[model samples]
Target: MLRIGLVGIGFMGRVHMLSFTDKPMIPNAYVKNGKLVAVCDIDSKKLEQAKKEIPSLEIFSDYKEMLASGKVDAVIIATPHYLHPLMGIEALKNKIPVLIEKPVGVFTKNVFELNEVASQNPDVVFGLLFNQRTNPFFVKAKEIIDNDGIGKLKRMNWMITNWYRPQKYYDNGSWRGTWAGEGGGVLMNQAPHQIDLWQWLCGMPTKVRAYCKFGKNRNVEVETDVTAYVEYPDGGSGVFVTSTHDAPGTNRLELIGNNGKIVIENEILSYKKLLVPENKLNETATANLMDPKNAPQFEEVIYTKKELGDIPWGVEHAITIENWINTIEGKEELIAPGIEGVKALELINSMLLSTFLDKEIELPIDSNKYYEELMKKCEKSEFKDTWRV
Candidate 1:
């Protein structure tokens, strides 16, 4: 049986714990042979509270101590964004299978370092907590795109603002919205899923020009609102707008291509398949200005239970975790490997860099320059923290 220890007992950490222990009761909590053996956190009170809930649960204050103790066969790193790569590297170096929580790291350089270590330990199981990869709607979108369902993408737009965080939410934790602690705002924390899904379904854009508003709605040091314009290599363009202030916000993705257009929002996918490809129409039509003679056909896709709107959050997480455990046992492949995480991080870094330079930034951003700029913000941050333990 795989003995799993979870590092960090914060919000996400607790969610992981619930997925492990509350078996039949928890959504998507199905693994052949694994047990929740230990948990680690810096706060002793939190550890004590955890022990009270699970009397047999082993607790440690330091992750290093827990790793060296040999009580766990695998470790789940659910700590802060900055600590993800660092903690994951330590687990990999210890020859322990690791499943790290998302965004990989705050920056690409750190993730590269962790990836280097992961490369050397090729046999060790390394999975990322990109649970949204399990969503059915996204899965169908990827399948359609890969199969040329949209045929030569021309435009993409995603307006995701469901991330509504009030000032009290940020004030509740020391590391909530600071540059030093959580990295960026909506892009880093709330929108990583959408960003990852964006690239997963539509492919990464070559250039990004972003306008980010820091603390525009909340009293935080990082950006709470952002709108970015991206250009693709195939003459495709995209607009991504996200914020944490908009209540009754929208989560919509629209992808237009030569063959048709796809719209996904609020648990529904509306696909518009043109009878004649837009490119074909443009080439064959003789009229000075004209629409396609044959009207476009539209259909609402009925998602299987596995699709986006159907899967519960806890179930999706459990499904990803099960894939990780099965991968470690050589019974199955990982749903989301640790390496693919770099794409999202690259996008995040590029957006921030574009915002800082007030110009369009290209893909594969200058990691060193971004790191230098990020450190400058961290150095000048005026956020007061009386909540760290």
Candidate 2:
């Protein structure tokens, strides 16, 4: 079996465990194909708790020692957002495949460095836990776009409000609100899935203009609310909106394309393709590719929709775990490998920098410049209730 080691027993760390057990998000191979050999955390209490949950596990307080022991064939890093790249680098240095949790890192530079380490160690597989990639709804959406059903996407919009966080939640951990610790507020934590979706479905926008409110929802330093505008090279445009403050949450996606319109609400997807432009359809029953206003109606094709459950750490994390295992075995390509991590990291950093600059940030941002700036912010900042244990 593919032996695995997991580090960080916080919310995400537990999430990684649950993610592996539930096969919906991750492929069954990860569960049946591998084994969870060890669990690690810096907090002794947390380590003890993890043992209670998984009594048979080989528990450790030192991840470095765990790595050196070579008991596990791969590693999963679910530490805080900032620790991802650092832990990932260490994992790769040991020639071990690593599946790191999202945001990849607080800044682009860290992600790039981690990627460099990944490239050098091709023998070792590296993946980010962008599990939403494995969701059926999103998978269906990608298929539609690939088949050109949307037909040269003209515009798209997302209003995701179900993600709500309270002040107490941030207060629970001193590192929760700080830029140095968590990296960002909603953008990094609550909305990375949306970010990955927006950029993934429509392609990374050439331009990203965003406006955000800092400490808006609670007494923390980060954006709780954000609305971003994006522009694609082919004149395709999309809007990404998110908030951790709204109540009676509303989640929706609206897409308008040359051939049709698509909407996904409450996980029920629907779409209609107009065959004729209204300007011409008034005179004759004709379909227009340029402007299909009267296209034949088409209802959204329902893929065997799975009830959205408690969103796991993400969909691909476990599958990525398996990919790491297979990569080690020379069995297959990494499911959600390193380059994808870089892209996801780039999108997240661009949005944060957009808020800071009060301007639209360009794609393919200068990661090196941002890393230095982020480091400066981290060095001077103080953590409120940072974990001392």
Candidate 3:
């Protein structure tokens, strides 16, 4: 069996630990070939609690000690945002496979450096916990796009604001909503999955112009609301809007292409396929501007939650963990490679940088410039008791 060591026995750490057991909290989904052999954390109380939960499990106060003890074949990092790349680098240097939680690092520079180390250790199974990738609807959307069901993307819009967090949620942890602690607000915390899926399905934008509201109706120092306009390489454009304060919030994604349009909202996928490509109609149409003959012919198909059987809540998290363990055992490939984590980081960093500089930021952003800006915020940040690796 694959021996898995988990770092940072916090909320997400506990969630990952659940998946390693035969009887996971999420029924019918567990890592069959792996077990949580060791756990490391700074909190003695959490370590004691973990020991109580798994009496046979080894516990450590220092992660480096755990990595050096040779008790675990792999490590899963569930630490804070800033420590992700640092711990990942340490694990890679120790030649241990690692699965990291999302938004790989606070900024692109650190993530790029982590990717560099990951590239050097090509044989290591480095993965990221982007659990939303396991959703059947998203997988099906990817299939349709890859098969040219939606030809030549023209526009994309995703307004995902369903991740509503109350003030008490932020107040629960010292490192919850501060810039020095958790990095950005909704983009870094709540919307990284959607941003990943956005770029995963529609591709990255070449330029981004964003407007953000920092501490908007929230007692935090980071952005709570954001609206960004992006331009693609093919002259295509897109918009992304997200927030953590919108109640009765919306989760919608619309993709318009040359041959069809796809709308995913309310756990349903609505696809409209045109009989003739829009460009073809534009070029060959002989009818008058308002003629009925010029009307477009199309077919619509709707896919609902009923199409996909009962998926227990939070099961995808276990599924992602299983995929990582399988990849380590050479049974399958990684679904969310650690290197791809940088794309979403770059996109979010660009959005914040755009809001910071009040201008449109281009792709392949100046990482040094962004780092400098982030450091300025860090220097002024009030949350100084942030976790360190």
| Backbone clashes under 3 angstroms, per model | 3, 11, 0
lDDT digits (tens) for residues 62-107 of candidate 3? 9999999999999999988899999999999999999999879999
- Locate the minimum summed-lDDT window of 10 residues in model 2: 22-31
Model 1 lDDT per residue over 168-203, tens place = 999897788998878889999999988988888888
> Which residue runs of candidate 2 sit more than 4 Å off their true CA positions?
18-30, 276-332, 384-389
**lDDT, candidate 2, 196-276, per-residue tens:** 777678777788888878789688877788888888899989887888889977889887777777777866767566655
Residue 262 of model 2, lDDT score: 73
lDDT of 1: 0.85
Q: lDDT (CA) for every model shown?
A: 0.85, 0.74, 0.89
Tell me the alpha-carbon RMSD of every candidate.
2.8, 4.5, 1.7
Task: List TM-scores for all candidates, in order.
Answer: 0.92, 0.85, 0.96
Global fold similarity of model 1 (TM-score): 0.92
